[model samples]
Target: MPYRISRLGLVEIRSLDLDRDLDYYLNVLGLQLTAREGKTAYLKGWDERHAYSFALTESDRAGMVRMAFRTVDPEDLDYYEKRLKDFGIKYDIIPEDYRRGRALRFTAPSGHTVELYNEMDYTGNVLPTVNPGPWPEGLRGIAPPRLDHTLVTAPEPGKAIEFFQTVLEFRLSEMLVAPDGTIIAAWLWQRPAPHDLAIVPGKPGGFHHAAFVVDSADALFRAADILAMHKARIDYGPGRHGITRGTTIYFFDPSGNRLETFGGYTAYQMDPDSRAIRWTQDQIGPAVFYYSQELNETFLSVYT
Candidate 1:
């Protein structure tokens, strides 16, 4: 690999009522409202080191605008530009503060916009750098530390996997393969976690859900309380997933876009010799919902 993607970075979201979503994200999700520049409102978790890790843009419909990741090396942007060009993908270089300091935004094989950039405005985690405690005081609802991963729907999971694996250097963590060995869903990551991104089978350009990782299973239960208090729509979860063995809850934001609060997965570590874990399509339901041992139609069909 020419370079490495350090972690999942900012996610740009499109919402029907930006203010309504902003209120939910800030008050219910416990993210801080960092700034409102132009039509986009930015939010960051209390523990995020970046200025803001979430962006909400008002739109006619609710969905994802794009997802981004940071690079291990700041100069990796130029290296990615070359790699994308060699692969015949058109891309643009966005300069400072457009999204962050500088970025390379491009369309991926999955028909979703993706950005790669190493620069972001560093905003401290609101704790002293020396002897910081486990958490900050007065933290609000759901209050996850940072973004863990996101799942997007794509027409061709295999193609998307190829782009992620070969171009961006994401390694496969797990996947669901059909009887004929066609990959229908896949989890990929460059980090130590199980996944930073997952491609699920659906219409091209669809976004399934973005998951924010909490510290434990108890956090998911608490998140359920907050969602119920606000009368938020929860699609699935307060259940554990056999796939990653992580506890999760799938709920809808005010805009009807699905959001997941999750935590506690079996740790995954990889080496050059590592291989992906696979599941047959017959086991899909239980793979996703460990307790249910079956997937609900809504879970399989819903996407923004």
Candidate 2:
């Protein structure tokens, strides 16, 4: 069967300091605050049409609450329900909340809370549909175009990869393997981007980073400048990746949640016969950070 899961729609992350994090998201990352219900704040990129794509909820600790993907059609939820049942996975039917429609919420093998939904109220982009300018005026910080992809951690990445490939029909784009044939990390995609979701071996429920896409390579450099100006903790990048060939800059939010501004990656289409690119553990250094040819300690160890 063809892939029914379309793309990543929303990511809800927890914040120990909601106000500070909210300010970073608005003034630094350049996301528009769309709404606030109690302790939760909803936000979206200027170019996004959904009511919101990223959400921040107040909590004592920092981590990901859940990540959601949108299906190709409303009925696709039914197809997934059957698949989940057949795989003996349990799930809940979440009623419409805020601007989002009802959804199927489940816990994956990696212990991450995943949600699949089909509808979100469209709020349109920042510009008019017809005769729109190149970009909106009064943009702040490193205003990215949209939320791109996310990387989360699992103790056994292979099992999480299996769940995505088998249950959601996400195809593998790239993977890192050990000499003994253990899968160290895997990048899987439903959309044309290199990876809509990636998994690496770490503590269960760990969120590595959520990436946002900029316009070009120059934009990525500008993003680094903006991040430096704000004195945000820069984790890595303003460099290239050997895996996806993308330019990236990794930084931390106020609550220690890592986030990335990424761009210029090769797009991978949904072709069944397409072979996944592989990197052995020996080349792990260059595979992850092509320019540095090494991994930073915090890149792997520090995650929310």
Candidate 3:
């Protein structure tokens, strides 16, 4: 059987300071703010069914525990539910909401909560918000039409990889492991946009930075300059990663969750059943370091 994932729908991150965080994502990042409720807000970078790439929920603690992707339609949701049942996996369905739109939630084998939503409630008068000023000139913006991927950390890395492959129908495109087999990392995707999600073994239930693709290397540098100019701390490299073949830079938004911008990544197109490929240590560096020089020790210490 074939399974298709259309797009990353909405990422929910818990936040306590909604005003400051939302300002950074909307005004600075240039995502168009669409709608607002009491503590929840929606913003989007490109034209889509809904208002945003990420939805912020106010809380004392902040972190992402749920990720939603879009299935083709109601029938597609049924097909996915059936696929989960075939493997004896458990899930929950969320009907339409004034808040989340429409979606179903299930736990991936690695016990990551995943949701699939179809419709984004629309209002007739949707327009791109005022240009939040020029996005640091020469800086490539997340050029991909939409938000593409998120990297998640799982304490039980091996089981997580199995769950994504068996229950969610994601195929592994590449794998990186330490020589001792203690820390394992694998990249998996449903479509050709490189890995939509990557599994890294670490603190369970924690999210690594979500990645957005840039239009050009110039955008990447401009983004770096803008970030530095704004005094936003840089967390990781402007260096290239051999494994993903992308130039990556990491920083925390005013919100504190790590965010990454990349210029290039290898795209994978293969049957879900294709054999998984592995990368040696030399190919991918010692580890996927989250904190780079642009980010200072103080910021790095907080996440650790």
Better of 1 and 3 by lDDT: 1
Candidate with more favorable, higher lDDT: 2 or 3: 2
Candidate 2, residues 72-102: lDDT per residue as tens digits?
8999989998998998889999998789898
Top candidate, metric lDDT: 2
Q: Can you rank all candidates by TM-score, best first?
A: 2, 1, 3
Q: What is the C-alpha lDDT of each candidate?
A: 0.84, 0.89, 0.66
The CA-based lDDT of model 1 is what? 0.84
The number of clashing residue pairs in model 1 is 0
Every model's Cα RMSD, please? 1.6, 1.3, 5.0
Q: Which 10-residue window of candidate 1 scores lowest in summed lDDT?
A: 264-273
lDDT of 3 by residue, 18-108 (tens): 9988777665554556677889877665544455667777778767868888775667777777887798777777877655555668776
lDDT of 3 at 209: 71
Query: Each candidate: how many clashes?
Result: 0, 0, 8
TM-score of 3: 0.81
lDDT of 1 by residue, 181-214 (tens): 9888999978777888999988888889888877
Query: In candidate 3, what residue range of length 10 has the lowest lDDT sum?
Result: 134-143
